[model samples]
Target: MEIVPIDTPSLGDRSYVVHDGEVAFVVDPQRDIDRVLAVLRDRGARLTDVFETHVHNDYVTGGLALARATGAAYHVNAADPVSFERSPVKAGDLVEAGEAMRVRAVATPGHTFTHLVYLVESAGEPPAVFTGGSLLYGSVGRPDLLGSEHTRELAHAQYASANRLAAELPEETWVFPTHGFGSFCASAPSAASSSTIWRERQLNPVLTRSEQSYVDEPFDAYPAYYDHVAQLNLAGPGAPDLSFPRRAGTTELRRRIVAGEWVVDLRHRAAFAAGHVTGTLNFGIDGEFATYLGWLLPWGTPVTLLGETREQVARAQRELARIGIDRPAAAATGRPGTWTAGPISSFPTARFADLARAWQHRPVAIVDVRRDQEWRAEHVAGAVHIPLHELPGRLGEVPGGEAWVHCNSGYRSSIGASLLAAAGRRVVTVDDLFERAAPAGLDVVSRQVMA
Candidate 1:
């Protein structure tokens, strides 16, 4: 038996290819199906089944596409009522692959009401489980995805479902989860691709916590387009051609940058800050670049890139393509003076302690770039609240001073700081202000007074 995990960096999603001898099955396939087909062909395995652990909210799945291409049976949870060419898989439903591999559907509906986890039972080895959004490495899926009321019910169900799995599965059985550390599906770091049930039983915080705490803990905020992306996934996405634009020379790249076209520097943050095309947004190609790009930039915006090299640019293009944002007009060659105008500057970063001390001496304005809910919940004393999305238009509201900026995390702060700095305001980012402020009792400033 062979299990291959395919990590799609753009969406922070993982797809699986499980095969035994001549038969193969794919689980939660992303929009790219050719790679899966190529792998199966290389191994001389016949594609037999494509399974969707749950309907995704981040990227489109290729279940239907792979089914149409290879004439394999497509399976989705029976309770979902999803409108696709899928065979409804309920609890106890069995799927066989050749003479050696078998899968049993277990209804696990905490992430969504219709989610399922597959229990893989091979001919001679211990059974392994594929827990989709229901169970993750460190955290469980946010129950609030379906709405507050439904979330409560789902949370209870999820806790019960998890308990059921823990009891039924053996300690040594390998657990292959759908999403890991970097994925927005769960807050836990998905650095490890797979883990054993024993490890999760011992280390997974959410799984060990009481049911009430598991449900009530504040899950991180999701991007605004999550529902829209979910609809796309349910509808299924067509295969992308994956053919991006040719890399242009330094002059042409600079010309495009001058014409107000956005250049996304996909290099590491340090490499980008050291030297990048002027006015380029440094959304490092590491974590959730595609998701953030959709939030930060307008849809259908013409974009060039500053990758480590031409090959890196091509990889970045593929990452962008997963989210249906594939307009790679050109690539910058990292030549100095190529981009001469349009905010040739970088945002400043500072420690929260330093900003707090500076605030005591002078009237330095603090800009909280977190979401409206988060701002209302807790923010720094005397800080002006402007959500990152609304900051571009409300710049005039920001009082001129040595500005200090912060978000729930540093990503939005960097973006906000960049824009403010570009507009000629001195800016400094407060790294880890939320964690620091909360314990110090400085986070709970009066909202009424601020308003």
Candidate 2:
């Protein structure tokens, strides 16, 4: 028996394919099931079971279609309000995979009411538990995603869930959780990906802290897309639509933009800022493209992708499909000469060092377009704290001066600078890592800003 980890880097999600010679089970798959299918094919294994820990709030799950395609029994929480038929499993239920592997459902509710952790017992190996969101490496999943009113109740439940798992499982059991590695679902940032039950009990802040302190712990602001993802996941997300987008001429692209659809330029940030089609936004495919695009895009609204090459746009479409943003109504990919029409726009970018030097000669107001939790942790002494999502509505709050904008790694600040430029605001973009500013002679301030 062996377990393989498949990392979906865009969403920081990890799915597993646990196999025992010929039979296998897939756990918490992402919307794109191709990777799981490929793994199964490579191993010459038959997929017999598809399992989900909960109704996910960050991205759609492809378990239903994967089960349908492979004739596997789909297992999910019985209490979840999903429309599709599934083999509902509750606590204490054991699922047999093959001669050497089995899965045991353990009710561990905190991230959601119906959450479950699966304990896997395989031949010749120590027992390991798929903890899901209940117990993570350094921290646990946040409990308030269901609603703000459930914060205290869910936090208390989380405490109970952690204790229950620790008592039920042996200290040598391997702990695997789905919500940690660079994901917003975690209550605290994670330092590692995998841990043992004994190590987690010794080092996990969520388990060691007092119940009230853990409950009162602040959480980062969830993206607006999370609300949409929750509803779609519960209703059973549709299969990925792999059709190529209709290549838009200049006219159709303009029509879509005029009709309130956005033109997303998926080029590199530097190329995008140098010159792009006016009114289009930049969500470069270099880093976590799907996650950021899913967060910013309006649900069901049409979007046209503009990239420097055809392959770039196609790669972006594949990434977007994982988050259920498929079938882009129009796409344009070519050198700027073949594609863009009318006046192209550009924004001036400055380095943190340059901005710091200029700040001494003149008082500048920097726009820190990061999440509130990030801003509160550390920021420039007098930077404005408007998150990237709220930039449009709160544009007026940015005081007029030598305005400079930046995010942690400069991805979001590029978007913020474009929006401000489109709104006729003259601002210099600090297109550099915000954390690197301290060594570059910029004064940094830190605080425990509760979300």
Candidate 3:
């Protein structure tokens, strides 16, 4: 028996293909089904089943599409109100995928009200359970994705679910989870790349801590795009339309920028800060491109991608499609000068030391665009905490003056600086690590270590 993990690192989730020899089953695939198909082809295994642990809130699922393409049985929760046809599965149901592989659905409703974990048993290999968005490596799936009203109830249920898994599964059982690899779906960050049921029982907070203590986990804002993903999944998203958009020219790019549509530059932060088409936002294809772009772009707003090469734009399109941002309005690939006849806008990039030096000379409003947990952990003293997601709505709150934006690292701050620049604010992006702030002689403050 071989279990192959297909990772979508941008969304911080993993889908699994478990095969005995000739037949296989998949768990929680992303919207792009080609990757899964490639795995099946390489393994020389026919896909017999596709399973969804839950209706995901981070990215569109490709389970429906993959099943249709391969003639595999699409397995979804019996309780889920999905529009499309699926082999509805409930707790304790046993399913066979070829002669040698067996799957048992175990109800674990912490991540979502109808979440399930699949325990797969093969001829000789030890059992492995795919715990999607429930019991992660060292943490548990965040229960707040549904909303505040159900958060506490789900949190308690999550604790029960973790304990139940620990009590039922053997110590030798291998555990694989869909979340907690930097996914917002997890309640906390998990450092381990792999773990076993025994290790999780000994280390995971949900299993080790009291139910009350686990339920008290506080949550900050998640991506704004997350609000739409669950609905898209329930509606049965099909294969992504990934064909290249019409090649746009200088005139079309300018028109889109003037009309207030999103014109995203997919380049390095340094390249973007050096020079970019005026009014275009930098989502840097090298960074968390999809997560931030989907989070910041207003839902259904037309977007035009600007990249140095056609491949860069194509890469950005693939990432966007995972989060259900199907097609770009148009795309342009070339130098900034070629992108527009108008003057290209440029912003200054600085380091923490430069920020310290600048602070000694003039009044600068330091805008920290990290999440609340990051803010409370430690931040430069006197920095205004406006998370990147909230920056668009709360621009008026940033005090007037030359603004210096910084995140834990430079990725988010570059984004924040670009937004401020578009709003006509004088801004400098602190394009260095935040750890350098205190060493560079900036006053640093911390409320408490993040829980």
Superposing every Cα of model 1 onto the true structure, what RMSD results?
4.6
RMSD of candidate 2 to the truth, in angstroms, is 2.1
* Residue pairs whose backbone atoms clash in candidate 1: 180-190, 181-189, 181-190
lDDT of 1 at 444: 49
lDDT of 3 by residue, 1-451 (tens): 8999998888788999988779999999999999999999999999999999999999999999999999999999999999999999999999998999999999999889999999998877889999999889999898999999999999988889989999999998999999888788988877788899999988887787778877886887888899799999999999999999999999999999899999999999999999988788999999889999999888999999999998999999999999999999999998899998989899999999999999989899999999988888898888899999989999999999899999988999999999989888889999999889999999988675333
Per-model lDDT: 0.75, 0.83, 0.92
Off by over 4 Å in 1: 78-83, 190-193, 246-263, 271-279, 298-308, 326-333, 339-343, 346-363, 368-397, 406-412, 422-424, 428-451
Instruction: List TM-score per model, in order.
Output: 0.80, 0.95, 0.98
**What is the full ranking by TM-score, best candidate first?**
3, 2, 1
User: Model 1, poorest ten-residue lDDT window?
Assistant: 335-344
Give lDDT for model 3.
0.92
Name the lDDT of candidate 2: 0.83
- Candidate 3 wrong stretches, greater than 4 Å: 448-451
Strongest candidate by TM-score: 3
Could you give candidate 1's per-residue lDDT for residues 411-448 as a string of tens digits?
A: 66766776776566777776564777645444447567
Residue-level lDDT of model 2, residues 1-451, one tens digit each, is 7788888776777889989779999989888888899999999999999999988877778888899999999999888888989999999899999778889999888999899999999867989898777898788888999899898898899989997777668899998787787777877767686788889889987777788988888887877778877777888876797666889888777777667687888888888878877777788888777777777676787878888777888878888876777788789887555555777778778888988888888877889999987877898877789998888778899998657999998888888887777667777788898878888788788785422
lDDT, residue 316, candidate 3 = 95
